[model samples]
Target: MTQQHGKKIMIVTAPANGKRFCGETNYYEQLLTAVANSGGKGYVFPLDKNPMDRKGFYWDAPNRRWVAAFCPIPDIVYNRYPFKIRENKLACKRFFQWLDDQHIPCFNTAFFDKLTIATLLKNDAVLSAHAPLTEQLRSLEQLRRRLKKYPVVFLKDIHGAQGRGIWKVVRKGKSYQLHSQRKVFPSLTFPALSCLLQPVIKQRTLLIQQGIRSLKTADGVYDFRVLMMKEKKHWQCIGTGIRLAAHGGFTTHVKYGGKAASTNAALLRPPQAVVAFIGRHVGRLLDASYPHIREFSMDMVMDRNRQLWIVDINSKPMSFDENIIQQKRIRKLVNIFLKQGV
Candidate 1:
């Protein structure tokens, strides 16, 4: 009932016409190279706007380059298309449905919702200890109640990505202050806080989460991007890299002032075992909904007390910055998809 996947793989960079390819050309090249070296062949293509069944950029392994060549429908589809909105379009949805009709496998692409992920993790007894207390802020009253419990709380977009607009609300005695980006608003009363957040909630959903005092870097707060891949029997950890937030910044997002570093993997050794355990649990959880999900990535942080917390998870993981981690991940991925033959 299913199409037997071959070694030939189709790597989709975007819904249509995105030569940028996740803005990590080097990573793309490496993946293609790995596939080539592994004896399985592959091609890179845009998801739409082109004849997906017949043309793509093939790897010129000998010359160490990509060549414009005619391609056939791949045995497997490895979706690298990262834009959530584009992938949600009617046209894109139809294409994915078509893949389903053809029985061609595209392992993952259910763009994660932060609230759903947090709530699911919070509900799991084994994972609850590592999950921060979070709730959907449907109204100012909800946020006010949360503030009563946690001294500092964070507001994150339910559907947001790359750490955008994650604001902080810190309670100083009876006064509350909202911190957005680098700007810190003056202390406000409960009514004033309600007024400020009313428009935001009206526009989109925001989840208020318990803000733990995390380990700080010289730049700002930092967290580990734990990369994990799904194998047939278990989840394989690719590697971990640290992302340091920009000075006085709220998140460790590279597009913002945050940057990646190899700083102190030793410090994370103890928690990584736990992280791996959680990854396996998450692998099973996601696979249930996504069917045959190949992999996922997690954003984790260590609190000042040296306790690890699970902050986020994404099915469509971006490439890691650390060279070694990226290299290891590519090899593991190639082995997974190319085991069958091009």
Candidate 2:
């Protein structure tokens, strides 16, 4: 093990058996493969897996714990851990802090401590034009009042994803109906919405947004998935794809019966100029507001009038499948990290 000049890289992932799927899996594997092809060693470690739990956990490849043990640290760590850390959720935070204490070069810092991704976006001024007005809905009257200003309003769980527990309301004659699953699911389920809202609002974290009419495709509604990666000088756009909802659907999440497709396809018809413009703005705002975060996946929609709206900004976005890997960009990222000694 003494005659090599390769780097040791690791990707942070969710619990091995965690129910949800994150972008880290494919990113780690593909990056590792790229590193190996580039004469470097790559590894992976589940963020929640404590090396101390199992006296000798056997990782076939290099792991974070082992890298910390044998090499004292790694050249770089691709942080993709998504679980929330609350006052009651501080288990793994200490471990990352320990690594920080040792001067480990983590892509993201735990300095904010227990703040959710939404917290970062809550302030409208961060990207005021891109962000919608999100208010804490108190009663049916408040929701009704909001309808006057915003014909379409969104009722979302503070902690929602993949379109679950997200409802859109539109005026229908004298009344309004909630839209999801491409059809109305009984107008408004106040009890259901309230149950989801109360707990978070009690913490003053729940929010309701004024909905924007997103671009629609022949298949259904669609949104842009812009991949932003941090380079030595600045954040660059690696690539972009369109997430199209299944036929007659409101959300483009594959889990909710949505499918992924190329942005250039007819089904996801978007102007190249618009896409490029959005990408540049997203990169600029991220560098200004969250400089500590190296990568993010931004979800945006274009209304009928062609105004762009940012609906989601995830610090950690899902990685593309092997079929769509952009090899040149991956190599550039590796070279940047190696050159900077990150």
Candidate 3:
């Protein structure tokens, strides 16, 4: 009983299991392992309703990997649902309800939809200064209109992450060229474009956005991942890493081979003001509405005109290769778990 005290932190996960993991059976083991290393207890909880204590998972230090061991009832729950598809399930909502019924505080229970995130930023006075025009994707006419105003337009899945479910469009004369899957499709007539996108629109909720060109720098395109965490009621910046987009890559996600640059030979880096704008100002605004969002990684890019735009905001951001930032983030989270625990 004493061992579990002040250390039990539970992570709510999906039923897809750790089998989906490419390497480790459970990915959250890294977090739990960090918790173990940080003098706190952490475990992964599957999204089912079973009440078995050891059914979840705990970090097994001796084995140097995750093992199914007895996990004591946690002091708090951290929803680390891996996929948007899984997190969107009704089971996730009900699981949160169960945690609520038990009076267990859970953080980061849901995904921030792109449309809502855009609207939130656009409506805020200070954040709006850096916001881009975003609208729901409905018709072919909408695409044409967006292109008229901006040289490029992007159709992003409202709930997509890691650069999946995205389409890039560039305007040329009266026609448009669609870019996706690392290949450029031939130019299409307005009518043909509508026909092509109709199925995609019906399948997923995509947001039409004005695309901002990255600043012309010899140091490759910089897509930044700004990690922020709450220290008491205020937010603190953990680190800003350059997400290295592959040459002509549509997205800068590691899954697509874009990793954080190892060297800082960059022609440009994010200004502290830009970091503050997202970490302090925008972080507070987001927290005010979504109080459950304890931490988030903001994906941002600076344009040629030196304007920064938020491309994505995620509650369960993927791992960064940078050790220092990861260390700071893990320690902060461990402290939060300890402080928030019963």
Candidate 4:
């Protein structure tokens, strides 16, 4: 094990087999560059190749290729493993256990399930106030009973992301309507809710949540993506961006035709302080519940009444824009890694 620089930071992510770079490779490059610029070294590697007995494979930058080297175990690891890859492999489980045994600090330790997050928030006094009415749907009867409580509801897969596998159910007069990004099923006057959702649910557990009517513009509904990072042991809001749903879209997801723009000070209705409060509270809760989590990305929405609701908590959050990375938050994060000592 060799430490060329003061510290070695390893980014654990999925492998890009045949391509020049995967979708997440650019983000890893940015992270590595950041670490290098700050006088440290970084590399991206996949879990399968990371052996417990020896130094694993990592990207070699100067040579511009993947190379095998007996590099030192990283002083810090930032987990960016995609959920699909992590779920399908037992290697990922072992990798995390190895990290724990080695005492290597890693943030975004594991993927967060939507239902688990909702249940945790509901149990907290401060967080529950901002959490929507949510229930786990186990059967058709539960869905039918839940529909009677809210005029509009959202059926979400416990492990879904990128706006996929989500359905908006609206009660229209005597009938029900189901809306998705690409299609809409109108007048779902079925004998039972199971008839309509059984195929969609299909061996997956769903969460029935009261639909929130988020603020919208001419483009579509919008929400705030707040990036939070731990600075010297305390969580703080680093940057925020406004995500507008794409035309005719029901959810504001960047991949789902949603457009993200830097937050405009003039357009901030509830003030940045309020948003920070929400972010801080959620960050604290997550940090306390899940050890080794030093960062989070919170999808928050404000209704017409100016009340904030936390919609999603992303453990393995997407990389922020360059401007966000240039903020003091990133500097603090890097400093923490450097202080860990090689």
Best by TM-score: 3
* lDDT over C-alpha atoms for residue 65 of model 3: 65
- Candidate models: Cα lDDT each: 0.75, 0.59, 0.74, 0.73
Ranking by TM-score: 3, 4, 1, 2
Q: Give TM per candidate.
A: 0.88, 0.77, 0.90, 0.88
Q: What TM-score number comes out for model 2?
A: 0.77
Off by over 4 Å in 3: 1-6, 17-27, 49-54, 216-220
**Per-residue alpha-carbon lDDT of model 3 for 1-342, expressed as tens digits?**
334345688887655544522222334666677677767777776655454433666768678765665567667887777677766567666666767887778888677777788899899888887777888988777778788899888898877777888898888898888888577776788777778888998988889988888864453466778888887877888888887767776677776667677655545776866686567887888877785777888888888777788877887776666878877887777777775442
Model 2: which ten-residue window has the lowest total lDDT?
51-60
* Residue 20 of model 1, lDDT score: 26
Error of 3 at 129 (Å): 1.2
Writing each residue's lDDT as its tens digit, candidate 1 over 226-286 gives 8888766577777787888888887888877888866554344335677788788877776
Supply the global lDDT for candidate 3: 0.74
Candidate 2 residues 59-94, lDDT tens each?
A: 224442222222224566666556544212455666
Show where candidate 1 strays beyond 4 Å: 1-6, 15-23, 49-55, 59-71, 263-269, 340-342
Q: Tell me model 2's lDDT, rounded to 2 decimals.
A: 0.59
Better of 1 and 3 by TM-score: 3
Clashes found in each candidate (C-alpha, N, C closer than 3 A): 1, 0, 0, 0
Evaluate model 4: give its lDDT. Answer: 0.73
Query: Where in model 4 is the C-alpha error above 4 Å?
Result: 1-5, 20-23, 49-71, 84-88, 262-268, 325-329, 340-342
